[model samples]
Each structure stands twice: as structure tokens, then as C-alpha cells.
Target: MVSFLFLDFDGVLHPQYDGEPTPKEVCFCHLPRFEAVMRRYPGVQIVISSTWRQQFGMLQLRAFFSTDIARRIVGITPTYPADGPPRMHIREWEILQWLKQHHASNKQWVALDDSQGDFRDYRHRVVFCQPWEGLSEHRAVQLSKALQGTRL
Candidate 1:
């Protein structure tokens, strides 16, 4: 069974913005549906796997979920290394590393992100979303179906 749902904040939960974009600056449209889905599936872990860590740090997590349910989140994977240059690749690496550390294979979880490049190996496991679009009813339905074992 899929035990975890890894989320990318900018394109999946919040609108993708370059400058002046903070979690507080963006609105969460599909949060109600997301909460509904979560309520329907207990014990399923949700992890923030976004690059916001590199841009805004850990505070972004609380800021993003400030008005929504926060208890569902289990962990977060930061986008950049503490001492290295900022790179989106770090996010993907961190995700894979996290999965490896937890002994969870690709089939056991899902990654919802905007970038569809380097993650080709796990493409079947990822739910790719457009950069400017946040979560929508279709994506929520897709997530619900995937959680129910229908891959898409």
C-alpha cells in the first residue's frame, strides 16, 4: 500500500512565483479537498518536498499550512544543502535519499512536483503539475485515485 504522499509546495499547493512570493502571499485553493482526502485515509503520511526550503527555509512550511490542517505532515525535505550552492537537484536527491533511508521504494509512495526532468526513473510514481497551477479538483481526484491504487 502507498504509505506516504510527498508534496511540492510551489506548483502543487501554492502558485509558483519568482520574487515576492511567500507562503502567506499565496492562497490555497484545494486545501479543503486535500483535507477531505486526508480524512478519508488515516495513517497516510504527508511530507513537504518542495524547493521552498532553499528560498524561504523551514518557516515556509508553517506559513503554507498556517490556515489548514498541519497535523497531517510527517516531515520535510529541504531543497538545498546547508553549505552548498542553491540547486533544485538537491530536492530530488533529498527525496530519493529519504526514501532510501526509510526503506520505501518508488511504488510505496508518490511525488507531486512541477519539474519532470531528472526524476525520469520515478516518473511513474510522480504526479507532475504545471508551474503556475496549484492543486485543483482534477489533481485531487488523481491523487485520490492514485491513493486508491489507480496509477496516473
Candidate 2:
């Protein structure tokens, strides 16, 4: 049983950034991909592991996701801490802390993020994504396979 699926909203779910000249929102492309993955794996628990906490509160975040793929999520973790060196760097720490608090070991969790850098010592468990390569069909299939292999 896969205990938790940590998802980064921006690049993985939505596009990497906003305010582009094309005016095409990243989120528009995300919904379909996210829905497809959700349909194939309904038993997995989804958690919001995005770094958008600086701009949106938990309520706003919940509402945003609820409008799109709400049924896929079990719950959102506490908003990422604000007072940190930088917003991007804090998510890894916050994720680790949350896992420890809930007694969810790394083996039972998989973090999908666009940040390609090593996750310090937890590099083995994280699934890194590229900014341009938002969740693809092949990646989703791989994730499903990984989840199945996870030790409950």
C-alpha cells in the first residue's frame, strides 16, 4: 500500500511559471494530465507539496485544487513555512518534517517535484521532474509502478 504521494503543484501539475507573453496559463495543461493519472490510481493518497504557500493560504489552495482535481486528494499539508532562506528550498525540509511527524518512512512515500537537484540525503526516494516535462503518460505509468512497489 502506497502511504503518500507528495505532489508539487506548479511544474508537475501546472506549468512552471506564470505571466508569460503568450498568456497561456500553465494550469490549463495540467488538469487533463492530472485527471488521467488520478483515474488510473484512485487508491493512492495525494498531498499538496507545492511551494505556492507564500502567495496562497491553505483555504485558497484547497479551493484552487478543489475546482480542478479535488477528488484525487486526501488532504493538503500545512502551508510551506514562509520565513525561510528562500521559498523553493523550504519545501524539501517541510516535506521531510511532515513525513517524520506522521511516522511515514521514505520507503512509503514518493515526492514528485520539478526541482532537479539532489534532495540532500533523501535523493533515492524523490522523483525529480524537468520544468518543460510536465507529468507525461509514461511518467505517470512509472509512478504507478513505483507506488505498487512501495512497502506499505
Model 2 CA lDDT for position 25:
56
Model 1 agreement with the true structure over 20-81: per-residue lDDT tens digits: 46466465665566678767777678777875555664455766563445666767764445
Model 1 off-target regions past 4 Å?
A: 19-25, 54-69, 78-90
Clashing pairs in 1: none
TM-score of each: 0.75, 0.71
- C-alpha lDDT score of every prediction, in listed order: 0.69, 0.63
User: Least lDDT summed over 10 consecutive residues: which range in candidate 2?
Assistant: 19-28
Model 2 quality (TM-score): 0.71
Compose the digit string of candidate 2's lDDT tens values, residues 1-152: 66677788666765565534222554636656666665566676777777565566666766755444565565555555456455444556767777777766553677777775525665555666666666776666666666775522
Top-TM-score candidate index = 1
- Model 2 spans > 4 angstroms off: 18-24, 65-89, 103-107, 150-152
